[model samples]
Target: METARSQQQTAPGAFLAFARFALCGGGVGIASSFAITALAAWMPWSLANAAITVVSTLLATELHARFTFGAGGRATRSQHAQSAGSAAAAYAVTCLAMLLLHQLVATPGAVLEQIVYLSASALAGVARFAVLRLVVFARNHAQTQKPQNPQQPPRRHAVAGAAQGGLISRSESVEVTLAS
Candidate 1:
């Protein structure tokens, strides 16, 4: 059977998913920036950034599962773990870019720093999208489907016709079963 999830994995579906991903992830990223700035006023800068990243990642993963990839419900623990892995990579990417900029330039202006960070983050975000689509949330999603009661077997109805010297029997209906 062609499931809605399978349909969403197609070309148009991928486009829609990418759009939703941009909206959700971008929104979270923007919010995280402001949140980190505000929180930094009260706590250590590093601690504030870490706190915002954790909260933003949780929000983004949930949005991706439900709205971006159309996963039909909340994210699973496995999905959260995978998303965190990708987010960590993205964090490392941005951090490394800044470190490189500082080492190469004696004094880089705030504008240059923002450009480098945003560029690195954009690259990482693209990679994260692919990982989320093809790795983290790639499943049949059949669990959402209801199953027929195995205890009550399907009743078969048939007809028997006369043959040359015996009986010819055939089922009027066909029963098909699929595994996995």
Candidate 2:
């Protein structure tokens, strides 16, 4: 059963998680903005955006899995793929925002373009945070954070579980054990 303290922890925990997500993902987005611009000097804008998006998504997902979501380890391939979907959405939003900016103000100033792009990126980041926390890393975080049943005998696993079990299961196992 859930205790009062555990319940309280949920709200703050989520807030902290979002904070971390913003830090890691936002940092990557900011850097990628510059990267995409630099690459555009050598290639088409769309290709630059595509390349930067792919790289940033990979980097951000790993940071999120390890530090932001408290997944306790590296990200899985499945998580990376799900994260890419959200990243694609973000890329679309940024592209559309820039496109609209150009439509309204032909030959927009660089500052104006940056503002519009970053604003759109911020909006998409919020949605991406939800998707990442609740979807991409949900199972990983849940598996890491399960409370132990003190009354029951300790759980064992055939995979690479934690070296010791106390009141909880800290196993990093990806394998599911069936009860006989």
Candidate 3:
């Protein structure tokens, strides 16, 4: 029964995590696409795309680390590296898709190129989310099972004073009773 209840609770938590990932990923994608398109107007398409990918990936990594994966600001160096690696994998997929699309249509228009980029980015976002959840920020079972900050002092309780000699002050007595 406890296991079933825990699973039920975790299901909502998992969905919330996925929702955060998607929200952050979508924001990054839109910003990256705009930057890429603008750069492409002034520079070579491939160069602009690559530059934007790196910048956006870094932004997305930080966002995912803090918001999506609940890593707070304590992500380890290895985790950061893994996040970057996942970004690279996603970038590779987008680049490959772009290449394939270019091959299919010679001299594709700017609008068509943008369309392909957005499509590829959407697909890569899905892949990136999976990698981020499963590999980059994978939670260890032991860590989850263990209490955090075990070395820290336990919380003080007013009842502890009353237990000693009923010597607690009026405020402490009220606190203890309220706590009970």
Q: Model 3 — TM-score against the truth?
A: 0.69
All candidates' lDDT scores? 0.72, 0.77, 0.70
Question: Which model is ahead, 1 or 2, in terms of TM-score?
Answer: 2
Write the residue-wise lDDT of candidate 2 on 1-180 in tens digits: 332233334433688998998899899989988887788789986788889899999999999988887665789999999999999999899888887888899788767877887899999999999999889888754543444453444343433223354434555432332222
Please report the TM-score between candidate 1 and the true structure. 0.67
Estimate candidate 3's RMSD in Å: 8.8
Best by TM-score: 2
Return the number of clashes found in candidate 3: 0
Query: Residue 15, candidate 1: how far off, in angstroms?
Result: 1.0
Task: In model 3, state the lDDT of residue 79.
Answer: 73
| Candidate 1 C-alpha lDDT tens digits along 113-171 | 65776778779889999999888877524332322455544433232333322544343
TM-score of each: 0.67, 0.74, 0.69
Colliding pairs, model 2:
none
Task: Look at candidate 1 and tell me the lDDT of residue 60.
Answer: 96
Global CA lDDT computed for model 3: 0.70
State residue 118's C-alpha deviation in candidate 2, in Å: 0.7
